[model samples]
Target: MTHYRSFVALGDSFTEGLNDPAADDRGGAPDRFRGWADRVAERLAALDPEFRYANLAVRGKLIDQIVAEQVPLAVGMRPDLVSFCAGGNDLLRPGSDPDRMAKKLAGAVRDLRATGAEVLLFTGVDPRDTPIMRRARGTFAIFYLHVRSIADLYGCRLVDQWSMQGLRDWRAWSDDRLHMNEEGHRMVAAKVCDVLGVPTEDDWRMSWPPRERVDPRVKRREDVQWVRSHLGPWVVRRLRGRSSGDDLDPKRPDLKPFG
Candidate 1:
């Protein structure tokens, strides 16, 4: 097997493995190897046993934040292969705009490609039919399309995460109804390996379903219960304040404010 000297992953929560309820140590340490990026890395290393990998993904990051924070690190790594998975948070808003997200995503692709790395772009699954995510279906679909276009334009390998994981099935996701569980991540990793032309082990079957597939009715009820139980007074207070005004201050001095 040919060896890739370095691998880098860039993106947001899905890339960072946020809210993976099935994770053994959820909400404390980040799910490093549990996410798809690390799973891909694990497969790569299994073949070569000396592959170096770095993950620059952070939870709750938007495309803009990824450009600001993660891009520089990835460029510096000069990785042999770089995998990118992002844009879910950008689609979370009610009026999420895919055109703007596409522009930012294109910029990220350009920046990564400038380093001459072999880029692998991982697209996201749409959880719109899920109780918590139904409203953002359009946004996710648009983002996924744009991401595919960007990958093609930049000459990167595109991993169709939506098709690979069966996004139409609510059971493929974690309890949060957002991120993928261990099985889902494994499926994503398998697809990525396929794109990269990496051989899979005997245990790495391509069509395995998730261990636990929550019934849609039960998932909806649990989603409601989670919102009621987890969304405490402080969260309500914060949300109310956000509702009263625009949370994204156009003149915020900290960020490199958009013109």
Candidate 2:
């Protein structure tokens, strides 16, 4: 198997491991989403004691921002491998241009690959299981294909999250219906490792037991609650032209040795 002694990940919340809180996150400046990148790092470190990993992902960054900021730092680090996940937040907005974003991302991939490092890119997941996410599925699918085109053009090994069968269950999502929970992140990590040809333990395809039936009225009530807690706040943020990553720096900014 090919060995990657150093790894660096960059992108938004999904790459940052959102909603998947760390087990022993000491009180810190910003929240930690112990995402799939960290898990993959751990596995890599276990195989090679000299392994080092860095994740330069922040929450709510657009493709242009990620390209402008994270790409340079990642290229400078010169890691043997780089994983990038971006452009989802842009698609989440109404009428966000997919071609321009795909071009920006392709440029980043081109630059990163010029450093002679292996590049890994991911596609947007199929969120049709979530009612709100389903509404934008058509638009998001176009974005997904744009990414696919970039991956193909750049010769990047793509992690097709949209094709993941395990994500069909609603339980794979967090309370916000946007980010994935711990289990979903784990499955993603496994999928990444599978793509990278790294060994893993658990079966990511394992789904939860059947859910009990819920009354239509109860489901409607939960939908209202979801709006109050998650959707409403997101809309407010969008309206204000603010991002969750605003005023926040990447959690693991430096590329260094890992545990």
Candidate 3:
């Protein structure tokens, strides 16, 4: 496995760490915030303090926007390693074309790889596992398959996030049914380390313990609340042509020596 001295992450909310709030005050950029990429960077920095990292992901970015904005910035950084996650938001758009999105993503991968970075890519997860995303399961699958094709064509390292059975488990997600929780992010970090030959203390594929089931009535109420809190706003945004990342800046914009 190559020991990356410099790394930069690109894509969306999943890579931004979202609900997985940062825990440690490590000078490491990824660790200054909590997210799978940050966790991975934390472990890599531990192995080699010379490692430096940056995260350029913002929530709700579309594939074309990522290619147009983040790709150039990442190429400029010229990190030895780049982990990219995109297309999820695009796939969710109404009347989205999976092939077109995939093509744009492939182009982005090509540009980023031209900078001589070992680009890593991820596929969208199964929507059937989430109540909110269920309506778009078919679309997500189309996007996911194209990602696989792009990975093969470009020789980019592919982390088949969709194949991770553990991710389907509700424990791997938050109530929003979109982003992963802190525990889920940690699991993903461990998985990425395992993929890149970084040693980990435990397996990320472990299943959740069985627990008593919640009442069906409570589940219904939770669903109603989710529609009100998350889905309703999402609809409004679509209607108003706005995005979650409309005014958001990259969480960690520069790559510097990490603790």
Candidate 4:
């Protein structure tokens, strides 16, 4: 298997690892966030002492913003491995065209590929059963197909999130119903390792233990609370043309050795 000496990840909140705060056991700073990319980097670092990684992802970035802000830096870093996951934020907007977004992403991928780095891409997870997101399942699928096509055309590695049945469970997601929780990030890391031919103890497809079903009344109350706490503010931001990441920067900007 090819041993990548360096890896750089580019995209928005998912790549930035929102909602999944860094744990003490992971040796990450308590104030910082640690997502699946960080988890993947840890495993990769174990394979080689000199392995370096950088994450140029921020929260609330649209596809265009990512292409403009993150892609160029990733190219300059010249890492042997690259992961790109964008366009989900755009898909959330009304009248967003998946085809156009795909074209933009394809151009970025083309440039990344020109650098001879092994590019990795991800499909948005299945959102059919997800609240609010379920409304845009059709759009998400279109974009996912485009991503698959790009991966095939460019010979990049793919993490097919749509096929990961394990993520379909509510336990895999955070209370916001947008980003994944700690368990969700862990599973994603395992999946990435599997794709990169890295040996890992965790299995992305591992089944969850049996649990009692939630009462329908309690579920209804939670839904109302979610709308008030999460969905309401998100809609307001869209109206005002703002983002959650407006003041945020990438947690790990430099391509340096990872522990």
Instruction: Say which candidate scores most in lDDT.
Output: 4
**Tens-digit lDDT track of model 4 for 195-237:** 9998989999988888898999998999999999999999999
**Model 1 lDDT-worst window of ten:** 250-259
Off by over 4 Å in 2: 25-31
lDDT of 3: 0.85
Better of 1 and 3 by lDDT: 3
Worst lDDT window (10 residues) for model 4? 23-32
In order, candidate lDDTs are 0.67, 0.87, 0.85, 0.93
lDDT of 1 by residue, 15-56 (tens): 654444333354654433357766776777766555677766
Q: What does candidate 2's lDDT look like per residue over 172-219, in tens digits?
A: 879998898888899999999998999999667676898999999999
Per-residue lDDT tens digits for candidate 3, residues 1-259, read: 6688998999989998877876565553534347899888888898887999999999989888888989899999999999999888877777889888888888889998899998988886778867656898888888888888888898888888777788888887777888898888888887888778888785778788886899999989999999999999998998999998899999889988764
Give the C-alpha miss distance for residue 62 in model 4, angstroms: 0.5
Superposed by TM-score, candidate 1 places the C-alpha of residue 138 at a distance from the truth, in angstroms, of 1.9
What CA root-mean-square deviation does each model show from the true structure?
Answer: 7.6, 1.9, 2.7, 1.8
Query: How far off is residue 32 in model 2, in Å?
Result: 2.4
Query: How many steric clashes between backbone atoms does each model show?
Result: 1, 0, 0, 0
In model 4, the runs with Cα more than 4 Å from the true position are 23-30
Model 4, global lDDT: 0.93
lDDT of 2 at 58: 92
Candidate 2 versus truth, CA RMSD in Å, comes to 1.9
